[model samples]
Target: MQILPELGAAVASRRKHLGLKQGEVAAMSGVSQEVLSRFERGKVAEFGSRKLLAILGVLGMEIQFVPFIPAGSLDDLRLERGGGS
Candidate 1:
């Protein structure tokens, strides 16, 4: 799942790339213009999946899931270094 900020930025960038305005997307997606604006700005605390899908549909974008790659910890900080003490 994408973070809200990233999603919002992507939507904004896509919309701009398509030469669409917030109001135009809002009308086409059936989402309020203010809500669309807030979402584009990543100012909304909560956004529903339906709304997100609708907006993305209008923008000709879709969400994708990818494997989460865990970060590696510092070997020196690990408890078991497997080295002669």
Candidate 2:
């Protein structure tokens, strides 16, 4: 999975592991439940990055820009990860 969906899954997993419902997280994060649900499902194609960061903050997470890797390197990593088609 790409980073966004993977991040979403991680957030969902963490929320579930903490015994927090989507509505509770949304309320605590000042986001709508629908938005939170969509985000958790990785359907946030139109969601803003600011809101994403806000949710991450509420989840005790943060986003960071790490060093870049070339597309070829990513492909090689994917293949090594057994994600190749």
How many residue pairs clash per model? 0, 0
Best by TM-score: 1
Off by over 4 Å in 1: 72-77, 80-85
Which pairs clash (backbone N, Cα, C closer than 3 Å) in model 2? none
Of candidate 1, the 10-residue stretch with the lowest lDDT total is 76-85
Which pairs in model 1 have colliding backbones?
Answer: none
Model 2: per-residue Cα lDDT over 1-85, one tens digit each: 3776787898899889888999988998889999888887988766678877888888888877788766667778889899996
Quantify all predictions' global Cα lDDT against the true fold. Answer: 0.88, 0.83
Candidate 1 matches the true fold with a TM-score of 0.82
Q: Residue 32 lDDT in model 1?
A: 94
